[model samples]
Target: MASRDEVECWLTDMDGVLVHENHALPGAAALLQQWQDQGKPFLVLTNNSIFTPRDLSARLRSSGLDVPEEFIWTSALATADFLKSQVPGGSAFVIGEAGITTALHEAGFIMTETDPDYVVVGETRNYSFEAITKAIRLIVNGARFIVTNPDATGPSADGPLPATGAIAALITKATGKEPYVVGKPNPMMFRSAMNRIGAHSENTAMIGDRMDTDIVAGIEAGLHTILVLTGISDQAEIERYPFRPDEILQGVHELVENDPFLAEIND
Candidate 1:
């Protein structure tokens, strides 16, 4: 693993590493601002496909984070990029919110339900039975199955809500076909973000809270990984995974206070 001085680019998970339940962790914004002031390349990778980057930026700002839309990369955008690469100007039967649809549109994909090239799914509160049935039938009728992420459940004020993975499972059972997951743990999204930022993998570092998704993906992408214990996984849970992060911290606060490279910026 490379030291902090080797990090020329940074990628961090949004939901946990920087914020928890719509609240910013201590020093999260300051750390991001420091990176920005240093002209560092960084991106906030998120699996939430319910909102576009613009919408998410507003939400994060409301919670006291100063991230801009351009600095945010969502699974929806990655999925759209994948689809565009696979079939340029193809159509899709989408079961998602404005995030997914907007990305597809931007990628030159026409949205349809009848004999589309793909059946794309993402996070949405309005997961209707009709939509699922249509998606299943579309897949069975030869449309390829694609989902934004493999997250079975998403954090919510009311508790865990059935996410894209859970809904994708139902459609898989109905059509006897699985979906191509395009978010974290796949490494493709990370590669895309790195490319978008024009950063080499070896010079990048990923800071996240989850071992399964964020850390694993970072390792797979050949980037240094840092796990923070502000959200899902903790020190005790780190032993459960065969793969490990390059470093672990209490939270983003530690990075701001202790990282030598960041210290230079602060000084």
Candidate 2:
């Protein structure tokens, strides 16, 4: 594994590393500012593709963080790329937010409200019984299934909420069909993000909270991984997990403090 000093680009997960339930974790913003000031390259990679990079950028800035659309890479974007490979210019049934849908449309996939060539699932929004039935029928009628991520639930300021993976699971159970998932813990998303930045895993380090999806994916992608204890997976959980991170941090803000000049280093 390469040393932290050797890492040229850093990729981080947003929810656990930067905030919890909309509340900026201790030092999250400062850490981001610190990196920016130091000129340390970093990008925020997220599974939530409901919002466009621009939309998410505005939201992050509103929440007291300074982020730009260019610094964001979302699963929705990755899913769109995946769909492009599978069915370019083909019709699709997408169940997600504007970010995912807009990307799909831009990729030349037709978004249909009725029977379609393919069905894609992401974070659920206003899913009614009728919508479920329509999705089921389409799948039954030979529509291919594609899930953005398999996260069962996501962390929020309030607490945890059912994520798109949960909704995708419901559809899979109802239709007895499986969907191809493309998100963290899956190198497809990582590869896409790397491709976007033109950064190789050898020069990039993935810093995130969860071991399963975040760190595991980093390892599989041949990138260095750092486990942040700011969110889901705790210290004990890390010991039990098969994949291990190259380094551990309390949070993004703490990461800022870890600079040798900012904080004293000891043996």
Candidate 3:
């Protein structure tokens, strides 16, 4: 693994490492500013495919983080990238919002219901029964199944809401065909983000809060991994995972205050 000082690019989870509940975490602003001031290559990543990069950037601005749309990468973008590579100018029957649709459109993918190349599913609050039924029928008829993420549930003020994974399971049961997930824990998401920044695995670092998704994917991608305690994974939870991150901290604040990478930049 690359040491902190050797790292030249960064990939960080958005919700846990930088913001939570639409609020920027401690040192989150400082860390981002420091990266920008030094012209460091970095990208904020998320599994949520409900919002476009522009939408996420505005949301981060509302949280007091000045991340731009180009600096943000989402599962939808990665999925689009993958599909474009596999089948240029392909078509898909999609069940998602502007995030997924816009990305596919930008990739030159056609959105159609008739004998599409793939059945793409993403995160959305409104999971219409009719839409899901159509997706199932298409998959059964030989359309390839693809999902943005494997998150079974998403957090909300009320309770856990069914997410892409849950819906994917339903479709899988009906069609007896599993989807190719293109988000965290798959390592393809991190690789796609790195490719966007022209970063190599040997010199890239990933900072995240979840042991299962972020840390595991970082390790699989061969990037330096740092686990923070501000979100889902706790010390006890870390033990449950067989693998471990290279470093652990209370939050991004510690990186802002004492990271050797920042010190090297100042020097």
lDDT winner? 3
Report the lDDT of model 1 for residue 213.
93
TM-score, cand. 2 = 0.89
Better of 2 and 3 by TM-score: 3
Candidate that beats the other on lDDT, 2 or 3, i.e. the better one: 3
The Cα local distance difference test for each model comes to 0.91, 0.83, 0.95
lDDT by residue (1-267, candidate 3, tens digit) is: 748998889999999899999999988999999888888899999999999999999999999999999999999999999999999999999999999999999999999999999999999999999999999999999999999999999999999999999999999999999999999999999999999999999999999999999999999999999999999989899999899999998889888857654466559
Clashing pairs in 3: none
* TM-score ranking, high to low: 3, 1, 2
- Give the alpha carbon lDDT tens digit for every residue of 111-225 in model 2: 8966687888877556667767788889988999988888888766688888888888889998999998998879889888888777888889898898888988999999988
Candidate 1 per-residue C-alpha lDDT over 1-267 given as tens digits, one digit per residue, 9 for 90 to 100? 568789989999998788887888877977998898888999999998889999999999999998999999999999999999999999999999999999999999999877899999999989999999999888988999999999999777789888999999999999999899999989999999998899999899999989999999999999999999988897779999999999998888777745554465568
Candidate 1: segments with Cα more than 4 A from true spot: 257-267
lDDT of 1: 0.91
* lDDT ranking, high to low: 3, 1, 2
